[model samples]
Target: MHYSFSKDFFWGAATSATQSEGRVEGDRKGENIWDYASKEYNHRFFDGVTTEQTSRFYEDYQEDIQKMADLSFNSFRTSISWSRLIPDGVGEVNPEAVVFYNQMLDELNAKGIQPFINLYHFDMPMKLQEIGGFENREVIQAYKKYAETCFELFGDKVAYWFTFNEPMIPAEAGYLHDRHYPYVVDFKRAAQVLHHIVLCHCEAIKSFREGGYSGKIGIIMDVIPVYPRSQHPADLYAAEMADLFYTKSLNDVILKGFYPEEIGEILRKYDQLPVVTTADKELLSATKIDLLGINYYRPRRVKARESVPNPEGVFSPEWFYDNYEMPGRRMNTSRGIEIYPKGLYDIAKKIQNEYGNIDWFVSENGIGIQDEEQYLQDDMVQDDYRIEFLEEHLSWLHQAMEEGSNCLGYHMWTFVDCWSWINAFKNRYGFYRMNLETGEKTVKKSGLWFKDVIENQGFDKNN
Candidate 1:
């Protein structure tokens, strides 16, 4: 069977500035939370690896862009670091960072790869964090001003713009899970941060429209299609609650301009609702995203909580549902995650049927392997498993496209195995293998396979 796509389809990958570009504190770049975290809390990172080490897109973007072109990529997505652009979080625009981004975008266009730019990717400035970050309404206005400054500087050089990538992660990881920076254990703060981030996104979109930029603006969402452990009503309701709280709380407002009433009810019951004003309601109702980027790596298998959560504890999403590893489920042990290709199709149908069939693309999806060096053979990784993983997921994506999905293209999680935050280089998720010691790069077998897929504009699994 042959699966084909349009010529304009984006056949590339997505990465973030902090994860790929080194020189964290150089060139007058402001310190982001990650930078501060790396210094203050080095014990959290794998092998004590910090953000100072990366694939070095800052110094090697020209070479890296050439390699992107060599991979037959039609489009590539990366974020502009907020701290690097505005060292103090507001007011001054770093001239050095401005020159670097301009050159990078120009180089990408020169190679004929459409640049998909995202403004924020969980890399909040340390200055903003000191001033209460998203918990403060003033920071939202500051973000909007930073966005407007981006428009003023490089609006003409770029076409596709995104306000934030997975805005909920900061709220969840930072405030609730104690995983990301500013690690706290307050569900109320999580809800407030989540709502404020959405408000920030609305303001950025408003800025884009008011500035009259011809380019498009949207958000890259991490859509984890959740499943129930059984057909029981309690399990089914658990799945729905998980979806509403984890996925739709932010998604609905961005795409549909309002929260599901049930979310309000659930939060209100626990005294966890965020502050929302009358004017904020008008802002959210007016600014809908132009397009969307769906990032799918796995699904969340949830079940009804077995034991009642302590009523005295502060409210969290997990109080309603419990995640269980259903026995005999297939797993991606390299990343310690479940492998369910059907979730991509299910996510597509959701956008097509519910979200007015808005323009969208697979902004990030890939398999990450621990200690990928074991697969190295003759100077390149013979990652047949990656090829198989891609074929399975893309087959479902193709089926969705044939069923009238408005998906534009598919981008893998990344092109280079960048510095993946606290995970560092422990998980390799890149097409081209990079040697951290020598700064060398070599295309893996999967890269060659994908190049042929893009060259032919399709794949024939039968072969």
Candidate 2:
């Protein structure tokens, strides 16, 4: 069966500046949190693989973008580094960054690929982190200015602007858990950081609207659909709580312009609620996005809490519901995430039914292979697993669109096997596999298949 899409559908992949633009110290580009952290706390990353080195898109973007065109991508999403743009995070826009971003955006447009620019992708300025990162309310105004700078500079070349990519991630990985920088394990700090990020997002939206940039601005959320382990009331309730915390906490504010009552109730119950002053509430209520970006990679399975938390114990998301390891669940061990295609469809239906069917897209969705090197055949990574992953997920997505979903397009997690924070290059997820040893990228078998999909507007599952 051939799954089809609209003639104007967007076809591309997403990447970030910190991961691909590997020029951290030159051209007056300010040191970002990753640059500072990788050097200061190098032991934290996998095999000490710091972010200082990765896909050198800074030098090779023209060629890389031409490659994107060759692969038939009509649209592409990437981010501008906050520190690189404003060296100090608050003042003095970097002149070199202006040149680089302008040229890059012009190149993308020249190649007939629409550019989706995100302001932040967890690459905070070291200066900001030194003060307080997202926890400091003052940083909100600074980010607002930085966002406005991007608008004034690049608005003519780009039409899609996203405020943040996966805001919940930094809240979880940085504060509640130790996956990313700051590595603090405080739930209260996480709440503060998350609330502050929402404020920052709204502030940027205000700037975009007030600046009158001829473009759409939104936030990219990692919307992990939560599922109950079973049909029992306990499991269902647990799933609901997980959804409220992981999914709705940000989606509601971005889409519906308000936080859910259940989120406040649980946060208040645990004394974990962040400050939501009258002014903050007013800003949130006043802000609304033109669209949204959905990055769905996995689903969360949960059951009712099996044990009680000690009063002295640290509060966390897991406190509300215990993670349930669903029996015989399909797993992508390399990334330690479940390979659940149905989750995408569930998320599509969720946006349709719960959120007034807002326009959105699969901003990031792909599998990662830790040992991708072993799959090399005839000097190309024969990533049939990735091909299958894309097909299954795209099939379900097509089904959702057939059922009246407002999904606009699909973008894979990345165009090249770019660097990930702590994992470094452990798991590769891209149509073009970058050889870390030589900075050379070779197209995978999937790239050839994806090019055909783009030209044909869809895919034939039977092939």
What's the residue-level lDDT of 398 in candidate 2?
Answer: 96
Model 2 root-mean-square deviation: 1.1
Candidate 1 local accuracy as lDDT?
0.91
TM-score of model 1 relative to the true fold? Answer: 0.98
Error of 1 at 24 (Å): 7.1
Candidate 1, residue 287: lDDT: 93
Local distance difference test values of all predictions, in order: 0.91, 0.91
Which stretches of model 1 miss by more than 4 angstroms? 24-26
Candidate 2 lDDT score at position 17: 95
- Candidate 1 residues 19-119, lDDT tens each? 99889445788899998998899999989888888899998999999998998998999999999999999988999999999999999999999999999
TM-score of each: 0.98, 0.98
Write out the backbone clash pairs for model 2.
none
| Counted clashes in each candidate structure | 0, 0
